[model samples]
Target: MDPVIDVRNLVKRFRGTRRTAFAPATPDSLALDHVDLAIPEGQIYGLIGANGAGKTTLLKVISTLLLPTSGEVRVLGHDLRTEEAAVRSCLGLVTNSERSFYYRLTGWQNLRYFTGLYGMDRTTLERRARPLVDRLGLSRAMDRDYRTYSTGMQRKLAFIRAFVLETPVLLLDEPTSSLDPLSSEEIRSLIAEECQARDQTVLLSANNLLDVERLAGRVGKMSQGRLTPVESASDLDESLRVARIWLRDPRSRVEATLRTWAGGSPGRPPVRWEVQERNQRTLLRVATEEPERMLPEFLQFLLGSGLAVESVDLRSVDLEEEFLLAAREAEAEASGASP
Candidate 1:
């Protein structure tokens, strides 16, 4: 079966500017580098990456917002270069940036106007959008001016517009960003439900790992303009277990000691540690296959260091850690291949 979205050696470059009036101009920077992707029909393909990893650039190109420098791109068998109108008709796009909306128009008015472009009548638009707005907690502000809407409300309006269009393909860039936990969950649920119910093919680019894990059946990591697909998160790293130790201390001493011990300790289990700030507390994450063995040792070490442990949690390796580990491996491989 042909993929709903297809690409062959796609590349996009942005022009760079001169350093100064008298300095040499910079060369064009490559945004997408010979990238190839094929997302099958009715599949939610999640693309994750750090900022500026070309995730948004790829989506923009697929959505016909930017022209590709070279190679082929096809959406629903329509050539992106030659049949852009066909591609646009078949896909709905929700961008992270909120500037796409008409500030002076009310939220409902904006939705009606955008849906009008898609040939959806006001009645149909209301029927489709009212539920989404209500579900996303934006019903009260539906008639309010868009300029006065909060960042989150503006984003919800974008989603309602896309969903109302009911295109066969949806391109979502950070749909859950800047959303509170409940709102994020609602958006994720809507995404999953909408795709399954409508049999739509969704290409989602997000920094939120949980969104990708929950919504995407097939996952890929985008780094340095290259995409690496994986069967599942567990394939990212051999160590599938993680232990998080919540330390009550707000000081950096705990982090420093952990780093020093991790780097200098001998015969230690193959584990990697990360210190994160959490609500005036420090979270020390230890990734290892042998969490049971490492937990005791870690607890002893922290107590010995005079750092008070608030609590400890043991869980499977989440998508966040998997993303980090995969990135590290990709960087290592790239370095090794460098001449």
Candidate 2:
């Protein structure tokens, strides 16, 4: 299958002014620098990074909201620069900030407004909008004025408006940013279900790792205006040397056991351990390449040291950790430091 979105050496830059008008221009203020990415058709692709990581800038270029300083971008086989109309026809967009809609208009009216812009007929509009209202759990509020709705309700409406076209590609920028947990889950489930059932391609940008990990088929981290495809969540986290270990007991013996195990034996000293208590459990964190081997031995030592092993869990590595590590590494490498 062909790629739904293909970007090569994508670059976007913003010019910043110095305090003095005559100041010389500098080259470090680029927003995106030679970013490359490929998103497959009918797949959920996640764009993750910290603030100022160029995630939104990349999306803007793909959606035609912003022009690239240089590089090539194609959406649904249409060149982003030359075939913008074709790209727009195949795309739907949902943003964190609510777009302007007729406040006095009912939910159905708002959707009808967008459908009309898409040149959908009355019959087709009703047929398409009704199901989306129901699927998004907006049937009850379909007749209510959009202005009277809560933030969550408005967000749901915004999402439905985007889906009104039933476009082949959906571009979501922090779709769940302001939603409550229940509403966020509801929207996430809807995105997943709709994408699978309709064979639609989705490119989602989010700082929430849990949501991205749950929804995306492949994850990419953006930093310093570049995008790097992560092999897996595990690989990203491992590159940062981040892992969580839970201890059954939060006692002196447990702490001592962790120190002893991490400090190594008399011949070779182990790495130092970082310990913290979270909720009812003690967390033991250490930078080590052999967590699997070290954890087992640590557990055995705990048992030998007279500590009960209630539960030992290795917390799953996720996208957030990967993004931070990648961003920091990029910064370090740019500054000529060893990452």
Candidate 3:
């Protein structure tokens, strides 16, 4: 089966500042660095990255809001350069910005006008949008000017419009941004239903790892303009667990020993550690994936390392920890690659 969205050797660059009378010239910055992605039908591909990491840049390039510097992008086999109109017809994009809507128009009016561009009449638009509006808690504000809506309401309006469009592919950037917990969950449910029931392909970029954990079938991390797919523990084995150990008054050698242990022998699970100043005491946090048989031995190793262990918390692995782990790994790789 052909992918619903295909991107190959994609690259995007923003020109840096030119030399001025008092400043030196700067090299161009790469927003996307030869990124390749293929999202299949009915799949939710969740993209997570830090600020300025090129997640949004990739989305905008696909949505045609920003053109790529080079390489191929296609939606439904329609080339983005030659078939932009066709590509646009196949995707509904939900951005966090309220600037996408007309300030003076009511939410309902904006919805009707946008859907009208897609050839949806009033009855069809209302039939498709009303339930989504109500479900997202935008029903009460539908008749008010969009500018009067709060940031969260504006985001809901964006979702309502995109959901009603019924496009085959959905490009969502921070769909749950500015939303409360309840609203975020509602949006997640709606996204899942749209993909599972309607078979719509969704590419979701979000900082909220929960959104990705709950909705995405595949998760990828974007770091320093490169895309790396990673398997979330939730989607993998249920036996995977994260243990966070807090140490009090730990010796300086405690960290070196822990690092050595983490990188020690073959077949050992990876461990990550960080120091924190908490409540006027020095605290050391060590997080690792420990299987049932390894926990006791790992604890003994820590005890023998001459470290004072304060408390240990163990639970199922979560996306938050996975996200942090990926970020730290990326930072480490970049650091090693630097001259």
Candidate 4:
């Protein structure tokens, strides 16, 4: 299958001015620097990174909101430069920027206006808006004025507006940023269900690692205007050698004992142990490679060293830590540092 979104060596720049004491100087800033990406149809692709990572810039270029300085971008087989109209017809975009809605108009009315612009008939508008409002839990507020709605409610309305036409490709930037936990979960579930049920292609940009881990089929990290693909959530978890261990006894000397063991081991990689109190119990995270092999011998050494033995438990690593480690490693390699 052909990629739904294909980008090759894409570049976008902005010219701005900086003021020195007596004069203003112009500088060229590159928002997207020689980025290459391919997003397959029917998959939820996550674009993740810290702010200023060019997530939004890439989205704008793909959605035809901004022109790239150079390179090729294609959406649904339409060249961004030559077939912008076709691309626009097939794409839906949602961003954190506040959208304007007629304050006096009811939610249903607002949707009707947008649907009319899309040339949707009255019956089709009702058919589409009704299910979307219900799915987004906006049934009660559908008849209320936009100005009276809370920020979260308005955001849900914006999302509903974007999906009303059922565009094949969706570009969402921080779709759940302002939502409460329950609302955020609801929206995420909807997006996931839509992707699976309709084979919709989605590119979601978010800073929330957990959200990406849960919803994305593939994850990519963006930094310095570049994007790099990453292993899937399961693969990332399996690649780590870090393990969390819970001891049976609450001994204050555990740290010293573990430190001695880590220092004495010649061939083993150095282990860093962090002790924390959780639910009034002690928890230790033993960072090392091959935890299964090391745990038995480490326990023995601890016992022989007179450290009280505690019931050992292993903890699972979450997606956030994995992302940070991956990003840091990539940054190090880019800066010519040893792994």
Q: Candidates' lDDT values, in order?
A: 0.83, 0.76, 0.80, 0.77
As a TM-score, model 2 comes out at 0.75
Task: Give the TM-score comparing model 3 with the true structure, all chains together.
Answer: 0.82
Ranking by lDDT: 1, 3, 4, 2
RMSD of 4: 6.1
lDDT of predicted model 2: 0.76
Of the pair 2 and 4, which is ahead by lDDT? Answer: 4
Q: Against the hidden true structure, what lDDT does model 4 obtain?
A: 0.77
- Candidates 1 and 2 compared by TM-score, better number: 1
For 157-216, candidate 4 gives per-residue lDDT tens digits of: 888887777899999988888788888888888788866777889999887776798888
lDDT, residue 187, model 1: 87
Cα-based lDDT at residue 247, candidate 3: 67
User: CA shift at 67, candidate 3, in angstroms?
Assistant: 1.7
Show model 3 residue runs off by greater than 4 Å.
22-25, 236-243, 249-308, 312-316, 332-339
Instruction: Kindly list the per-residue Cα lDDT of model 3 for residues 240-331, writing each as its tens digit.
Output: 46666666654455556666665556766665544445664445444444556676767788788776778887766567765565565566
The local distance difference test score of model 3 is: 0.80
Residue-level lDDT of model 2, residues 1-339, one tens digit each, is 668888989889887755567787665478898988888878888888877788888888889999988999999899988999999898998877875588899988888788788898878878877887887777989898998888888899888777768899999998898888999999898889888887888989997776787788888878777787876554555543545556667745556565555345554335324555678777655444566666666556667777666555554445654555565556655686433
Supply candidate 2's per-residue lDDT for 173: 91
In model 4, where do residues sit more than 4 Å from their true spots? Answer: 18-26, 241-317, 325-339
**Candidate 1 Cα misplacement greater than 4 A, ranges:** 22-24, 233-316, 326-339
